[model samples]
Each structure stands twice: as structure tokens, then as C-alpha cells.
Target chain A: MYLRGYVSSREFFEYNPPQKIQNLAIRDYCSSNKFNYLLSATEYSMKNSYLILDEFLKFRDGSDGLAFYSIFQLPLNFTLRQNIFDKILKKRKQLHFSLENLALKNKNDINLIHNLFFIKQSYQKCLSLTDIKQNLKL
Target chain B: MLNSTVLSKNFLSDGYLKIRPKNQKYLFEIQKIITNKISKTKLSKKNQISFLNNFHKFQNPSNLNDTRLKIYNYINSKSIFSKMYYEIVKEYLDILVGNELVMQNKINLSIQLPNDKSSILPMHSDTWSGDSPFEIVVWIPLVNCFKTKSMFILNPKESKHFYINYKKNSKKHDSKSLFNLYKSKFKWIDIKFGEVLIFNQCLPHGNVENITSETRWSLNCRFKSLFSPYGTKKIGEFFKPINIKPASVIGFNYNDPLAE
Candidate 1:
């Protein structure tokens, strides 16, 4: 539904999607085991459904979600997505958990909320996902 | 992940993208032309700072001096520049800011002398204002940068620590010592005269002193996202980065060409 306006993945099925991105996104979904949206995202035609796929995937979970921003914004790639996703998931969790509970914060708790604080003061210096994985040896 | 079309996803994953473009001659020529311009000048420490401040004042809004921003008009007329260079750079720009990205600035070159190298830029990320994350930084080192010369660091992995490790939480010490740390960690660029080093300016990057016998001449032209603010005029007309965004113009003036 999110990609309805933008051409979904189905449109490009019969023919080669126009942009270099289409081939990549389509192939990416084909390779992954959990790409249910890929069929929906690509409308078997050139529909620019990837943008909505990106928005939808962000709300979704696991690597498929990470793959959206990574593949589409290759230069941005997936590295920055860790922070972006962790924040999204943490917020989602909070919303769900708040219906039942809440969690405490600490110095060691520098995952999503912790990274969130650093967003304002020194956002420019914000590291991409690759840098963190490299530095922390993740 | 193993797509045939993917020509090394490493570049995308790494924030500091290092590409050896097929055509490098234009960069070399641009450096030579800039070197000639430098040789003709006295190149004083004060002059370097004044030039930086002048460029800054022309675009910065806090001051009343948004006048005479003529660097753009000057570069547009340069005989040494080729249309191809513009095309390639513009293509790269589109990659950074999308196909619709506009020219935020023309081009501004700086020859950082030993004396004034320590001032002005204080390890701030290119995103000090509202720089597009997708935007690309085309660093044309007009001068040779090496270990002894003005080289830099990519921090591909540790780069994410930029906001956290260095800015938000890093301890402060003497300015000289901190710069020394920056120098020590820096990977001196063994670049030829024309090689363009493309990186996300969001990555912590800067140059050391021009320890070499020659000077470190460089043109740092910052571009903005397509829909990003450009105040009232076209940014390319300024030839300098619109730091802090217009309205808070960080030293761009169009009415007065020599206001600087």
C-alpha cells in the first residue's frame, strides 16, 4: 500500500526496469529469503516503488529493513542504517513497551537512545555504520 | 550482496570514498593554474586568514557585509577550467545530492600557509549547518599532500565515532596538541597534482601543515542538497560554502565583487 503511488515491484516483472537502481533492488530482494515486499515493491514495471519500500522497510524489522536504505542509498549504504534503525526499533519498542512498561538508562546503554542524545550536539561528526563496525570491531 | 553489477560495495559502505577517476589531467592543470596564482602573490599569514574571513563574511549573516561576492563570476571566466571537469563534478554532485541537486557554490581555493593553518576550521563536520548527508565533498588538493605535506585521515570505521568520540565526548587539551593528534592519526595523501579525493565531509577530515618546500593549495567547494535553502540568489554565484545556511550567511556576497 505504501508503494501504491510509486510503482511497486510487480510492474517491472515482464521487462527490465529502467533505472540502474531497479535492477539492483529487484536482484537484492530475489537473493534474500525474506523479501515478501519485493514482489509488492516492484510492480513488474518501472514505478519507483523503492522509495516507499524504503519507508515500509524502516517500519519492518531484521536485515531486509536494513537492506532498503543500504541498497537505495548505497553511498549511505547500510552502515548509517544501524543507528537509524536502532532508533526506529527502539522507538517502536518504547511505544509497544509503554503500553505495558518502560526501561531505565545508563552509561553502558549507548545503543539507540544514547546515540539519540549525540544527534543534536555533534550530529555532523555522526559516524556511519561502517565506522562503528570497524572501530568497535563489530 | 554478491551482485555482478556491484563494483565493490566497499566504496558505498565507507564514508570516505577514494576514487581514482579515469581522467585526472584536468585536476593537475587546475593545480598548476592555482600554483601560478599563488606564486604571483606574497601569501602572508594575515592574508590567508583575511581571505578565509573574507570568504566567510561574504556568506555569514551575523555580519552586515554580504556584499561583493565575486569569486563565482571569476571562476566562471577562468580559461584553465574545462567543461568536462564541471560535468564530471556535477555528475558526482548529482550522485551525492540526487539528480536535481543545484550548485551551492562555484569554487573557492585556499593555500593554507604554516602560520594560519591552525586557525579558522576547528574540526567541525561539513554538516555544521544543514549539509545533505547524501552530498559529496570534492577535495581538490591543488598542492601535493603527503606525510610531511598536508595529508588527511578517512576513519572509515572509526568515522562514526566522529560525533561521539571527538566532538560530543572527547576531552579537550591544548589546541596545538590536539592538532598534533589529528596529524598523527592522519593518512597522508600521496596524491598527484590532479587526483580528486572524494569523501563525505561528515567524516572528520583536515590537512596538516605544508611541511614540504612548496605550499598546500586546495579548492574546497561545498554543494547543498537540491531542495536545500540558498537564500535569495543562486548559490553558485557565491563560490563559497553557505555555512550556517543563508539568512545566517557565512560570508557570501554577490552585489559587491571585491567586498572581501
Candidate 2:
């Protein structure tokens, strides 16, 4: 199967792993899974820009599926994320997350991905709450 | 006589140094602070050593991480703690690394309970993550560490060999299997409370499960020369300028008039 790797230049929250490292991981993922790794589409560094992602979706027929560096690289906005999922599912294309070694195969996979996002959001909230409490102490 | 030449040669050859700090005052102070935090009731100076050694009796494996984090957060919050930490090893670092240094922002505390598999650090190099190769880790134990109670570091010569054949070996084995293959090449560190261990972070080093009867308590912090190259962890976010000379201070603020 042909897989187009997606590498994000934009920071996810406070961290952005080096782009070279992300691509290396994607390359390793492709080689291990026996996917013909095509050239990756680098996402724009600008906040809220998904122009490349939109282009990839429009012209995704060239590739069998898309591979992301990580699950967190997906759109944080719930509706935007859902739309991407819907489009991929409707087209019956596979989505691979290299860092997590997971693939979106069915509706259950979408639910699992949603739960992970929820967990991440809650973890961030808890950290912020702790920060606020510490600030109040001062 | 421990001259700079001798010190540098020994450090480079062995990839580590286990020596007593210039003074024990700051070490005693740091130990006292941790003892107060971990102990339910105040302990006298005489019983503190035994209490630390037998810390597993007080903290179980399940709640050990929470306790360790709480203590870590508390210590790192205090400016005095970092100041004292650096003061103890100032002379050694001045000789080994450089006079102008940048220290890691947060000092890490490791608490390994006896027979606890949960807290084991599998064999790996810090450089495998984002740590700079220029950095050196200053590890201070709160109790006597020997055998499985302490950490093991691969000999520098063996480390070079491992890295030379890294691609071939890594393809064949995971970290655990790799450690097993080269287990005999690693030297287990034997350090006491007042002594400090400064080791090359590029060398493969980590601790196994503490099979000894006592628990293990140690603190580790990284330092690199101010002008040295940085890895993924950049200066402002991960490191702070701890020691800077007057010339460097002026250089930082100096703006060239020739530039447009």
C-alpha cells in the first residue's frame, strides 16, 4: 500500500519535535509496515492553517492512505477533527499514526482516537489547575 | 595531587568521577531538608542515615512515585536548594566542564525502593533522548549505593565499541537484550552519601531493580559549558545560565554598529 506521510511544522501546544526526527520516524514506520512511503507533505507552521491537509485530502487518490507523525498533530478543534475523520471514512481510506503504531480501521478506532484526545485535554487542564493553585499560593 | 590534567584524563578515560565534594556542609544541609520532607516525624541527626537507607519501610512501591514527585517539586522550587547543590560541586565542575556553565532548570530526584521493578531505569544513554552530548550529569546519593542499589555505566572503551556497532546491534536487540549482551562490560558505581559522581551522559548508563535490602535515593542534575552546543532542549526552556563571566555578560549585550 502507498502511504503519504504527514509532518507538521506547527507547534503542538508548547512542543514541536524537530521535523527531521518526525520524518525519520515516519520513514521507519513505513519500512516496518511494508508501505511504499511517498514524499511527505509538510504542514504550514502558521496557526490554524490546514491548507496542505486540504490539498492532500483533495488529491489523496494517488495514495492508498495517509500516515501522521503523531495523533496530537490532528486538529484540536472537535468539529474540524471530525470532518477529517468523516472524509477519510467515507472514502474508505486508512489513516496511520506512526508514533502510536495505530491505524484507523473502523468506527471503533475513531472512538479510541477521540478518547485519547479527551485524555490529553484533561491532562492539560489538570496541569493548568495545579499552576493556578501554585499562583494563588503566591 | 589532583591537577586539571589528571582530572580531565581520568574523566575522559573512565567516563565518570566519584569523589568527595570540597565541603560536606551543603550536602548535610540538602540531606537534612530531604529527611524532613520524607519523615513523618522529626528524626535526630544520629538516626537519619539509617532512616534514609530503610526508606522502603516508610514508602511502598505503589505510592513511591507520588512521594518522589512531591519531594522533587518541593526541592526544585527553592532557590537555596539549587544554589547549595551547585556550591558543593563548584570546584570539580570548574576543572571538569568550564567556569562558565549552564545548569538544567529542574534537578531530578530518583527514589528506588528495594525489590521494586516499577522504578528501574533500563540501560540507555541520555543523548538517545534530547540531552546534549556536551552535558555531564552530577549524581549525588543520599545513602550508600553498592551492587544493585546503585547505577551501572558502560566503560568508555566498551561504550565506543557499542556505538561503533550501534546500527547492527540495535537492529538485533532491544535495550534490555543489549544490556544483557554487554552486562560484563558495565561497572556498578559504589558511592557514599558525601561523595558525588559526575559522569558522561553520552555513555550508556542506568539502574536495575534494587535487589538490595535498602532503598536507593539519589539526585541528578546536568551541566554544560555556556558556549557549548545545545541539543533539542534549548537554553531558555531547558537550561539556565548558572555561572557567567563579566566578558560574556558584555558580549551578550554588545550590539555591532556595522550591522544594518
Candidate 3:
């Protein structure tokens, strides 16, 4: 019960529900339950979901986490979700391997830490999912 | 990507370039055409400059618009006018804008008489409206323009800084306020009869009321790369391809056989 909110729509339904079904379910759940609390929680989670690759990988790995969780909470179109899923999966593996090697080689470099922080902030502002969807529509 | 480094640097830094027209004959021809249309009589070459400079004396302020429109229509109706206009700035335009270009269909004529508040253009970038940033304007003055009779442009560096801070600054400042704030930073262009000024229309530029004694007579036209990204102005409506390379013509007409 405590981890139900963190479950991906795929695992929660035990079937690959179509995008329409997932969208309808999420909309219905929010309207019927504590709508304000759910909206705030979703907004907070979305603002901090900067590492899209990490989030996508965690969803794939079946992690019951809520700080930065599944894309299922947002009612994204089918093609957009599929496109984002493919891209994030590929980038996740590449970024993780490269960053891990760099961290091991330069453990005490303050410049690397500063660069990482800057990159993270820039990515957060640029890669917001709502913004991405709007751009895609345009 | 430009072949001339100095030209590129000067253009990028100053946001404008004023140079002597490549052919003075074509400029004179254009001036003759304009003078003929405006005066409705054969004016000698010696008096052409004086006549254009003192244009306000010929007509009342109320009839200025009608006279301007009539002259504009008469000049543009002649097929030789656009060709002559293009010839005046062909070299500079080839260096600044690309050789393959889309020229504006109708050239714009501006007649600013002394203390005419109705003819003032507010300070704003063409991009703020529907114009693409890739476009450049060729301004040709029929008479010597100086002091308040000339237009002003914000330098590229300061223009960039203003753009970056636009969201925060625009909340409190309107166009007039912004113009006042950056008045000292603007560069007033001084051009003569035999010269042409090509400027980046993406920068903030406009003119105040002509406070000088002489009237200002100028013609402006826009040109852009034939294949560059277009904003609100579509190809056939506002612009038309003036120079198309042979290869581009072939490519445009090529059709894939598999589609059928």
C-alpha cells in the first residue's frame, strides 16, 4: 500500500495497457481521490526529475521509488512516450558508463564536480517533460 | 563561412555597412525616374538633389501621402526600376547576403519632412514582427541624409545584451522607454546620394521625427537567402526568388519516380 503510488502503470496493471487506458486511469484516480495532494506530489516530482535517463532506467528495473518516479503519472501521447523511452534508454547506458569511468579517474577534481552541477541544472531547465511535449507538438 | 574576414567582422560588429554604390549610373537612373514621377516634368540632373531635399515645399503635408503613393506606384511599375535598384548594391549584397537571394517584390519609399510626427517609425526589430532574422535591408538615400533626418540602429553587442535581458526588462519598459534607455548606445547612420546602406534588420532600429531643415528621401528593400528559413513572409507573397542558381532550379524540379 505504501509503495502503490510509485508503481509503473505497466506493473500495476500486469499488462501493457494502451496509452489511452493509462491516461484514463490516471485521470480517474486523481479526480476520485485526494486530487490536490496528488497534483502537488506530481508537480514536485516532475520539477526534480532532471535525470530522465535515470528515471527511465529505474522504471524499467521495477524500482518502487517516488522522489523521481515513472512517466505513467503524466498522460503523454503514445508516439511521444515511445520516442522518449527509446532515447532515454540509450542515453542512460552511455552516460552512466562514461560518468562512472570519469569519477574513478578524477575523484578529487573540483572542476568536474562544478561542471556536473552546472550540466545538471541546465538539463533540468531544458529537458522538462511538459516543455518537451509542447515543442514536439510545435 | 564568409570569404572576406574583414567584411564579416565589420558587419557582425557594427550591424550595418555603408558603401559607395557599385554603379553610379544605375543610381542616377533611379533618381531620374523618381524625380520625373514626383515633379511631373523633366528636371535637370543639377537640380535633382535640391528638388528631392526640398520636397516638402512642393506639396502640403496633407497631400504628402497621396503624392508618395503615386510616386511609389509609378516607379515600381517600370521594369527597369528594380533592376537598377539591384545593380546599385549588387556587390555589397553579394558579400553581406548570399548571391542567391529572394528580393522583396515592392520597394518601400520613405519621405520624412521636417517635424513630421506622423511619419516616425518606433524603435523595434523586424524580427519582433514576422520578419526572419536572415533578412537584410538595403537602404538607398536619394538625397544627402544627416543629423535627425537619418535613422539609427543599436549596435550588435548591445542589442544582444538587450535581447538576453528582454523578459525581465520588457515588463516595465515599453518601446519608447527602451529607446530612451538605449538612446546613447544607438548609432545614427549618415549616408549620401551615391552610397547604399545594408543593415541587419534583426537589430533594433527606427527613426524619430525629422527635426532637420532638409527632407529625407530614401528607398528600402529586403533580401534574404533563397533557401533560408522563412518567418511569416511566404515565398510568393512578400518575397520572390530573384537569383536562382542552375543547380537549385534542377533540384526544385526533380521528382522521385518511386512516389508514383
Q: Please, what are the lDDT tens digits per residue for candidate 2 over residues B193-225?
A: 899999999999999999999989899999987
Taken over the whole model, the C-alpha lDDT of each candidate is 0.42, 0.84, 0.66
Residue by residue across B46-84, what tens digits does model 1's lDDT show? 354244323332333332121223333345456346344
Residue B163 of candidate 2: its Cα lDDT?
95
For model 3, the stretches where C-alpha displacement exceeds 4 angstroms are A1-138, B1-3
Error of 3 at A119 (Å): 41
| Pick by TM-score: 1 or 2, better one | 2
State the number of backbone clashes in model 3: 0
Q: Give the candidate number with the greatest DockQ.
A: 2
TM per model? 0.43, 0.67, 0.64
What is the C-alpha lDDT profile of model 1 across A21-44, one tens digit per residue? 544543444343233333333323
lDDT string, candidate 2, A31-84, tens digits:
978999988899999998988888897654588788888877888776788898
Tell me what TM-score chain B of candidate 2 gets against the true chain B: 0.97
Regions of model 1 farther than 4 Å from truth: A1-138, B1-8, B32-73, B76-84, B90-97, B114-122, B166-184, B228-260
Model 1 error, position B110 (Å): 1.5
Off by over 4 Å in 2: A1-138
Model 3 per-residue lDDT tens digits across residues A25-62 = 44444343333212112222343243443343454544
The CAPRI class of candidate 1 is incorrect
